[model samples]
Target: MKFDKDAWLLEAIRIKYIIPREDGTVWRRKWISADLKSMSREVHLIKQRTHKATQRVYFNLTFKGITKSVLVNRVIALAFLPNPLKLPQVNHIDGDKSHNYLKQPTPELVEKWGEYQLEWSTGRDNEKHAHANGLKTGRGSQNSNAKLTAPQVVEIRASAESPSAIAKQYGVARSTIVNILEGKTWIHV
Candidate 1:
């Protein structure tokens, strides 16, 4: 549970059994053991011969006094190896804690849960939050809007020969008359 400053990971392996493969090679089944003497009780179970509960032989560590216990398999010891990273918890580097090896660190399994602290704290996805800041309100805006009422536009059209001429004669911008003539933006016809 706590691999503290004083604590160290001890490498002790125990062979469960061996199975002969089709290629005439024997595969050794081994596990890791504890470094601390306090875990001696569980360590004894590793070498002891016990009765079979099911089909497979279960060679497990019996942590009598110590609350924390680890695998007593050699290959598993090789899997995690001499030391591990300062992780929030014990993680299987290769998705399998049984495959703990020094060179093969569990980078994928160990995620930075606190990396996006803000996201978790706010309870909102980053994309959902509109991170926009618009420009400040207008400053010094005169009668910039060429908002001429329909009646006003009609009068201008009637007084002048052409839309452009009407715009010029009525002191309105030429584009405004052209817009009215072409029935663009704001004007229906």
Candidate 2:
């Protein structure tokens, strides 16, 4: 049988992260830096332990005790070896890939998979939306948009136009203008 070297390196790297301690202990990790560079599963290189050595690497996964290497090109792989077989895609529910629990899956594996992963801008979602939208990129959203910003009021009044016109130009909602003009949110002009 031949051994795959590249595969061995990858499994070794991931094992350092996912595999439980040899003492049968589990540890929690913050986040796994995504692998931006991945190659074809079949792209195996013959890594000689020495110029003429025969030892090589083969990437494989094992849920419990069953170990075998499978060639498939993917950023992530799942192995369902123990009882109660599962689909082969692991989910980091909390966006923490090191929390490899076959337990409660998250929305990343559910409803909002990629749509909610957009980067956050002002009025955009951030950490607050992390649970509902795993692997989020943007800052959390403000709870509501009922109030006007102080700069918004100044832009409305100190300008040579009506609040409605300025509101349209600024892309802010219209009611925000009323709040600014009424001094309910920011100091009115």
Candidate 3:
């Protein structure tokens, strides 16, 4: 089926149909045949599957003998609105991928998602958002890869041994020792 002046269904790309946008729910459309004469324009809400690794809902679309897994969020966003920034990222407005295509996408929701979500961000904007949301935790003892605890960082700071010696004794990198001493990595100690 040809897209109705909306580019919602690109005949060249093998997109058969696009579901109507709704609030707080995901919708699906059926794939259409390439031959216009034999076209079966069956439109329905598709049931998507969540990827085990990414925890994001996706659907498989076959085009030109290649099956491509498309993310639900991106499909919904592209269907309902035009991306002004032309940035190749789709972010959930409420930080929930399960909330995909539940409501009509507004410019305000897109703007808010771009401003607040990190993975959808284009650059340092994500970092600023994380900091603002108190989600920037890769520092001091809060760092998941940290080998030493806060008390150990304090002890290391007050130690008389050289950085290299402290690093060897604590099984940490020499840079960790140097940064702790110079108040670069563990300033909280």
> lDDT values of the candidates?
0.34, 0.39, 0.59
In the range 1-189, model 2's lDDT, one tens digit per residue, is: 776433553554464433333221232232333462332333222221211231221234442233555322112232222213423322333354333233334565446443221121222222334424434422212225434444555657677777778788878877766666676554212
56-168 per-residue lDDT for model 1 (tens digits): 12233322223333322222323333334422232222232223233322344336321111111121222122221111122112124645654675665566477667766
TM-score of each: 0.21, 0.21, 0.51
> Looking at candidate 3, what is the lDDT of residue 133?
49
Go through the candidates in order and give the C-alpha RMSD of each one to the true structure: 24.2, 17.1, 8.5
- For candidate 3, the 10 contiguous residues with the lowest summed lDDT are 3-12
The CA lDDT at 6 in model 2 is 38
Model 3: per-residue lDDT, tens digit, 140-184?
Answer: 556787788878988898899999999999998999899889977
Misplaced by over 4 Å in model 3 are 1-16, 24-31, 36-38, 102-120, 123-141, 145-189
The best candidate in terms of TM-score: 3
Native-vs-model 2 lDDT?
Answer: 0.39
Best-to-worst lDDT order:
3, 2, 1
The worst-scoring run of ten residues by lDDT in candidate 2 lies at 115-124
